[model samples]
Target: MSELAGREVRFRNTDIALMLVAVLPALGVGGYGHLMLGIEILDKGEPDFSLFGVAKTLSAIVAALGIVLVGAQLRGRNATSIPPLVLRSLSGSMLFLLATALAVILVPRSLNHFVRELQPLSVLTEVVLVGALVFLVLSVSSAWRTGLGTLMGINGSVIHALLSGAVFLILMEETSWGQHWIGFGTPEAFKGNLQNETNLHNFYTYRFELVYYSTAVLAFVLLPAFWPKRLPQMLSQLGYYVPPTWFALFALPVCGLMYESWNIIPYQIWFFCGLLTAVVIGRNDTKLRMAALIQAALLMLSQLVFLTLGHNMEDGYELSEVREFFISVLIAGYALITWRRATGEGASASST
Candidate 1:
């Protein structure tokens, strides 16, 4: 009984500590903005150099701590909520996001260099998307081979097949349907698009980008982190796919971008809700705690970088490209995880 009590105390303390770490970004950035700069929740004004500097400093500190925590996690335990392959893909994806952030911070003017359409970054993003498409297709095949459809009394291939189609569409958009490679011209109708590209997204999809962001939050963050264990398990038994909670961190950076209009109370709440949700989801799970902290750190760092750009960000056009790259990586990681789950290999399924 005494040992059990001691363990409970340790768990509580760890929860408190992790909670504080998760909210450090909000406290540091929001506090400084409101108290020192007198910026209100509804104020659309920009923070001065002092506030920006504080945000940058705080973000840097938290991001460094997150990296340290990741290193510690790697050293302390071989166990993780994420599959080995999935984790590797996520690591590479995060590197790309971080590299983009660094380029924006260190050389603000070089934003175009990293984000310009058809650049190396764009090519890399397409490659990842292709990889993801293949994985989703394979997942569908695996489902069929495993007879999940017959077992579940529904078409198991439907979900993943649709997912594959979605990814394929995204890939086509990214490549302008191979027009750049095939040397074809954009249709006259497409000439009115912002980029005048053959891609459908250039026409109007970018205008409703929040739809994409919101969908990601729902699929990756909210669903995975908050849904009960039985829910995912039941769905899996039914031939439905649910993202594992481990994905919240990888998805947080993209989710964080939704609130750049800092003056908007709703957007702030949106981002913070997701932030807090990720923390709550990880409260007791060791692997999830690591994931939440690392993701929260990236969240802070991304907020700082983009906020500083402000009006100059051109409605976050360039930043969106970087995020899309991250999203592609995330999708690939998800496909990997899904494949593992279907095959009953790798890490066990996660729950909140």
Candidate 2:
């Protein structure tokens, strides 16, 4: 009787309610895709099977998966295992980033003077990316101090170290070795580059952009949501950081808005609806629900501004900057959570 009662408490009618809410949006996704297809045919005199259209379709499919996953996960759990501080930090970061995006889109002229090369919004991208680097560095230190290297194995820190090095490389490449702010001229060798930037990424960007997007999606979204629970917990015990499924709340924007061509109302609606239902539903805590509501609203408003006005902006490249900023946020959050987990101060009260 006690076991049955506990099961009932964990999986309540509210869980079902949230699942239904999520299903409504999932149902609309297909019809919405068809409608967009019809509209494209009308406007272009044929269906758009171009690269951009294909990318958009792929994004829609993923968004649908996101909706379904969120619902399924919530239906099985009483409440999220995410720590209050971590959840709040993720929500606050999303709010701030999305708000900044909307402001930049609506008032491009205001930040024009502050913009640097590849930063159509402001220098905020660099600042945030640097912040991510700081967290990663701290994570490395925490891992060593906790003897994670010895605890897990001889090479336990291998993954963390490699990740930090990769991020550092990305930062240096993005900043063009400080040429963007320091106002230095590109060297003779790099002057021949297509963008006339000192960075090497520009030369092979098109080749690796897809790989970067795919890796981020897998690492931040799919792995957390779908991987077996035991695997992640085991990894955490072994000093490898595995993000909780709820991290998807913070990752949806990155997945939906990574590519400018894939940024549209369909993806935006999918993102907002998924986030709103996933965060607020199935949680008994009023404060957490209210916080989630506010963050969801900010995400929706940001998408609205982008779809309505920013989509038509002359420089599509600016959209990538937004994606990069969110990626930085993800990295920072992951590092913080990792550090906590490594030091036996896990963020979540409940086991993840």
Candidate 3:
């Protein structure tokens, strides 16, 4: 027991050390960009061959490393375990990196900016729509199998149907439902209040983004907490293969950083959703709960610090970048700890 505890401590210390190694240089580059270039690398969309560009390159590398680290940790391999899953994930990651590199090389510098701008929106639309379709299929299949009868005034199929519909709505809004694709002009009603002539999001109010993302937060993070069994059984099956950490990571980026909609509301939704996810995953475990609380506190504190300090800078930083950075680190930390605990629990269960 003492040996096991010591090993765990050593492993945790190593993980922390690696994280510091990963983050410090990135932060240094960010600070340098802020001080010299008057740009926040993590938030800027401009593609220039100046200090800003260097900062963007470095930041991207760091972000990729961070993602790889999370993938490694969530592969469920400890010191004694062979890392087949980790290797597989790493290979896929390498292929993605290779493709990105090829694109960068093949595309002209003038067109690179255009590619970068379109990539995020395209990726966001695809992910959301695909997820919605999956959920819709699962919900329909589950309802078909279980019969769409209500129990105690609550219907499982109805809840899932709502989730699917909401996600589809968000997807439509994101894509403007082929309005932009089809090259049609904005509607007259939307045109009068247009924030940006070309952008649909700016045409309407920020309320659109808020409602869509908030509904997502509620369905995926909050609703599951209130009634775990409310989720489709087919969807729940994913938990066996994909850890909650992946969802937390994916949602954190999309909720806060994906769209430039409202100020801080999207981030607040992400923050709470993360906290709720921690609570659900921790269950009745005191240590896990404590860790979750600490993570939440730290996330809030970091945001406060960023907002306070950000105003002093010339080109004020994006709050989303700050939110994303802190949440990613916190998610990685807690996910690793919870993963260890889960493995320990499983081992004990099997022994008993």
Residue-pair clashes per candidate: 0, 0, 0
TM-score of candidate 3 to 2 decimals:
0.40
Sliding window of 10 residues with minimal summed lDDT for model 3: 343-352
Q: Which has the better TM-score: candidate 1, or candidate 2?
A: 1
lDDT of 3 by residue, 1-352 (tens): 1122222212246666665675566567667767986754324332244654455445545543543343233232112222354334323423432332333334323222332323643544445455545645465446545644233444545544554565455456545665645767876666655443344565544454455455545433333222222124444332221223323322322233221222222233344445444444344323234433444444344444333333333333233322223333332332332233233332221100
How much is the lDDT of residue 54 in candidate 1? 50
> How well does each candidate superpose onto the true structure, as a TM-score?
0.68, 0.64, 0.40
lDDT per model vs. reference: 0.59, 0.55, 0.39
Give per-residue lDDT, candidate 1, residue 127: 92
Give the residue spans of candidate 1 off by over 4 A. 1-98, 149-152, 231-240, 257-270, 309-316, 350-352
Which TM-score value belongs to model 1?
0.68
Better of 1 and 3 by TM-score: 1
lDDT digits (tens) for residues 1-352 of candidate 1:
1122122112235545654675577566667768887765344444334647456445534533442333222211121345675577556645655766666666655665766766887888999998998888887877677644332466667766887899899888788989867879888978998778887776666344646665766676655554432323334353136565556656776655532444433345446555565556456456657666666677767676767654454334566567677777778877887676555552355331
Q: After superposing candidate 3, which stretches have Cα over 4 Å from the reference?
A: 1-117, 148-159, 195-204, 222-283, 286-352
lDDT, candidate 2, 259-333, per-residue tens = 244434243334544454445432433434555555556666665565456534545455555666667768767
In Å, residue 287's CA in model 1 sits off its true spot by 3.7
Instruction: Name the top TM-score candidate.
Output: 1
Residue 209 lDDT, candidate 2, scale 0-100: 55
